[model samples]
Target: MRISQSYIILREVRFHAFHGVMPQERKVGADFTVSLRVGVDLSLPAESDDVADTLNYATLYEVVKQQMEIPSQLLEHVAGRIGKAVMDTFPQVTGVDVTLTKLNPPMGADCAGASVELHLINDKTKV
Candidate 1:
């Protein structure tokens, strides 16, 4: 049997502002929700009972926060960037699911929000 371990960090991230194709959007920044699911092999850590043997989630959070601060035109791009950032920052991270939600999209139609989700994995690892 195979075992999987993961954690999710879900929160609304507010930006000072400029991130969109329209001038209005750039002028009045908006609230965005960033949800991340990070997965890694925890067998070693579980067996050894050592923090050093596992990926540190606290460090991952800091990296995600830093990346969210940077403005991007498309939520898809933001999600991709965040996924890569997580993998690059944590060597132990094997896979990641990144989703970004725009609270107030410019669509005139009645809509709660728009979101995009992407999953990325480290090709080097089979986990």
Candidate 2:
């Protein structure tokens, strides 16, 4: 089997948190969505049929949830933190892409929300 590229995704993980520049935003908080695309080499896991050979998705979620609990002034900051956390905790992770969205933003726009995306490539991924 040839696994040219492999990644795991967690889509639309929802949370309510205080993350904004405005004071009211920090006070009232807002609904948010977090999506993650995690890159890794799936060759070992594919053949071994073992969770130990692959990333632990539950651990990944805990990492994300921990970051989300921390209040930040910008989505950029939050997203970057999440990406870095994943890379730091998982040596098997090759890359991480994080997307954070604030639902029904306080800003005076009719749009659904505002978002920020961050990407990080692991320098310590195992060969």
Best by lDDT: 2
Task: Give stretches of model 2 more than 4 Å off.
Answer: none
What do the candidate models score in CA lDDT, each in turn?
A: 0.75, 0.91
RMSD of each: 2.6, 1.3
Q: How many times do residue backbones clash in model 1?
A: 0
Per-residue lDDT of candidate 2, residues 10-125 (tens digit): 99899999999999999989999999999988899899999999898899999999999999999999999999999888877889989999999987889888999887888887
**Can you tell me which runs of candidate 1 are displaced by over 4 Å?**
1-17, 47-49
lDDT of 1 by residue, 1-127 (tens): 4555655454555444456777777777777777778777777777889988877767776777787778778878878888998888876677888877887788886777788999898775667
What 10-residue stretch in candidate 1 is worst by lDDT?
Answer: 8-17
- Whole-model alpha-carbon lDDT for candidate 2: 0.91
| Pairs of residues at least 3 apart in sequence or in different chains that clash in candidate 1 | none
